[model samples]
Target: MNASSDGSTTLFVLLGRIADRTLDDATRREAVLVEATLRDSIRAKALDVPDIAQAARAARERGVTVHLLDDGGLGPYETAVADEIRGAIVGHLRCATSGSITVRILPAGRPTLAAVVVQSGDHTERYEFPAPTGEQAHTLFHGLRRGVGRSHS
Candidate 1:
């Protein structure tokens, strides 16, 4: 996906085939919580705010449901961006199956995030990406997608 005109916004485009079915009830509920938390965090940001509201609206328009998790206390802005990226990734995974994607932003040594995708029949895949800053978070977002694509191919 191309970066936004100002270059601060990273457009997450899902190139994979979207599934025909909707997310399960529990998963759908979780997605709502994540979106709400993300929206709150974005509003609390002091600077470098991304257009999360716009992206979320577009995702809803496309019927994309997203779910996410974050460890408390990691920089709000970074965590918000990571959460946003994770939500998009989860939405992409939903297109393939009733699978679930859980994104965790760890409060470890450095800003690190992990995405665990669990497919139907119990198959699972995990990806780790660095999210030290907004730009790095964007790179991590794309890297995860590219890595997943390569694995499936």
Candidate 2:
């Protein structure tokens, strides 16, 4: 999460709950197959892309402050953890999004799969973007990692 100069905070939150479940040989293989199928569906547009816009609409109706950040040119792997580790994150402008994803791997002749669940919320989402130099980016990376370590505890 990052706070804007205007004193509102925009947080990007990821919530995941991992579970332990026992599956027999056949069942475990099936799970992997299913994940690959779903991934293909989304990629082919057989499944609709994610609908973040709907959440924005609901926030507007309820009179809750909402800010959307669309930082382009950054790949998913990088952007996924970028803002969360930035120095500018602060305040009640806490915006949060939660989700779960499952990935399974099976033996030969079987399949591998993954599933994800997502939820997003905001008290008052304050989006922020400050051009950080290379040194600043390095600092942000370490800071974010430190924050993540604390949360796990």
Candidate 3:
């Protein structure tokens, strides 16, 4: 569905959920095709092309915090997008959760970026990203290191 142009900033959140019996294989494939067609149509009619870095910078300037989880092995464009996202995030979390799913970020020693562990019920998966620079690490881990302040008695 298209977003309403009501002066508010639009955030397009896309979550690719695992296919299930309810959706079936064919239905899932058709859904993907339909989304691609819509995206192509929008791109064709758009006056200005979207830039990831510029968008991320705009969001940051508006005091909006961003968080990113890169699953690695991205194409050139996707890698650029990930870099922009990384630049926008104010802080990173060691762990984040959504319902039954939990994402845990772990240090991958030298060279490699941190590894991410995704746990859902009995299933678990892991992925790694390129190592962050010292400054980037500080920016990313600030929230992870900062615990909730003590309550006043």
Candidate 1 weakest ten by summed lDDT: 9-18
| Model 2 residue 83 lDDT score | 37
Better of 1 and 2 by TM-score: 1
Say which candidate scores most in TM-score.
Answer: 1
What is the TM-score of each predicted model, taking all chains together? 0.37, 0.23, 0.22
Model 1 per-residue lDDT tens digits across residues 1-153 = 111242222211111111434456754554554444454354323211244333433444444443445454245546555455545544444354344444444554554544444344556555555545646645545544322422220
Q: What's each prediction's clash count?
A: 1, 3, 0
Which has the better TM-score: candidate 2, or candidate 3?
A: 2
**Model 2, 74-139: lDDT tens per residue?**
222244333332222221112323321111111222211111112344222222233334465445
The per-residue C-alpha lDDT of model 1 at residue 8 equals: 25
lDDT of each: 0.42, 0.27, 0.32
lDDT of 3 at 119: 45
Question: How many angstroms is residue 95 displaced in model 1 relative to the true structure, after the best TM-score fit?
Answer: 3.1
